[model samples]
Target: MKTWLTRCLLGGLLVTSPALAQDDDAPYAYPEDEPARDEQQEAEEDAYERRRRQVDETDDFRRVSEEEGEEGDFKELAGVDDPNIGFAVELIGGALLLDSSEGNFAKTVAGLGLRATWEYGRTFNLEPLRENLWADLRWTYGSYSDGTDFIRGDTGVHYFTVAPAYELKLGKTSLGIFGQLGGGIGYQTTSITIDAAETKVNGIKPVFQYGVGLRGRPRLSNKLSLSFRVEAMGFRRGYLNDIFLGGSIGTAF
Candidate 1:
């Protein structure tokens, strides 16, 4: 009876083992899906690679823009023949002396002047003229104050000048030479007491004169400069024979 029971148990185990083996084989039925899984994985990897390349391209473009900005080449401008043009102002200061005084006596004169200059050249020539010639018209108004005994009085004078100029450039500096020929009328008033009354030296004296001058300019830019000028004028009338001298420091723009 024990032997028969053992054989029955062995038979039951053999039947169950075959069913388990069949179930394991059933899981391998769809072999075709393996290739699809592999393809999906490869597609995902390709998409990741494309995204990385796009990010890299954006970074490269940004870097190039930053470098261009740092170089500052975009700030440079072009197309002008010369950057300098238009009107300017100058302030003049210097001494005055009567030309006919004959070295017998001298009086001290101090005065101020206002002037305007124009340029016609298109190039920044060390010499700023055409064939070394430039033309300018200026008006000068000034007063003389005296502290000496020879002629103790205050005098005012007005004159206009037409100057044709020339220039010489040395390195960054420019030296100008010019002469003017023009005339204007003037009057003389005096503070001397004649018979207990202050009197005028002369009434509406007519003044006529010519002058010569020198100037210099230092470049501050292609368009701007620092300017200096000195000029001397001589009168025509023997009595009004006076030497008018002046200096100006200002800007040319």
Candidate 2:
């Protein structure tokens, strides 16, 4: 019985010795070098924080870029306008003499005059006058017959005239009444044949004219317009002592 008790006591002591050894090593089982899980968790959190900061910075840059683009577009739209348009016209016509200091000359005397005109001007207010004022220059040619009692009988006189004038607007459509005043220099040439005798005479004179007339215009295209004007004027000179009636139709460009 004593020996068996002693063996039992020895086995108990062995078991207790092993339990004491395990308790002493428990504090050193988890070392600072073996903290792999904690290190991994901290590293993951740091990476996540870095990624979040990058996302925030990218969004801030995107917003700033959008604002700058809008500002650039507004600055490109602020300077200068367009231009105004204009044109000129030329009218030509036949002329008739209306007065005579020489008697019974209408049935016996023959006369004709040609007129050339140039007009140019532009709109002032554009709403009030598309074409405001115009300047006109004219050339006239005329021929007439003489009576039997004159020194050079069975003969005639020819006249040439150059006139400069101006016109003001009374209305639109080129079909309206207008008043004009102008003066110019003239030249006269005479030819006579009596009893098989021929003679020639020439002279220079100054001329004055006043007229009121109507104009009618028809449009052909955007760059071209056709116009007509009827005008009358008085002429007094060594060659002609009469009033003249005339009409003209021409193109404008």
Pairs of residues clashing in candidate 1: none
Residues 215-243 of candidate 1: C-alpha lDDT, one tens digit per residue: 77778897788888788866554364667
Report the lDDT tens digits of candidate 2 across residue range 95-210. Answer: 54634545645432333544444443333333333344444556555565655644454333334444444445545545656676667666666668675677877767787666
Local error of candidate 2 at residue 229 (angstroms) = 0.6
Per-prediction TM-score to the true structure, in the order listed: 0.50, 0.51
Model 2 misplacement above 4 A: 1-95, 98-116, 123-130, 147-172, 238-240
List lDDT for all candidates, in order.
0.61, 0.56
Q: To one decimal, what is the Cα RMSD in angstroms of model 2 from the true structure? A: 20.3
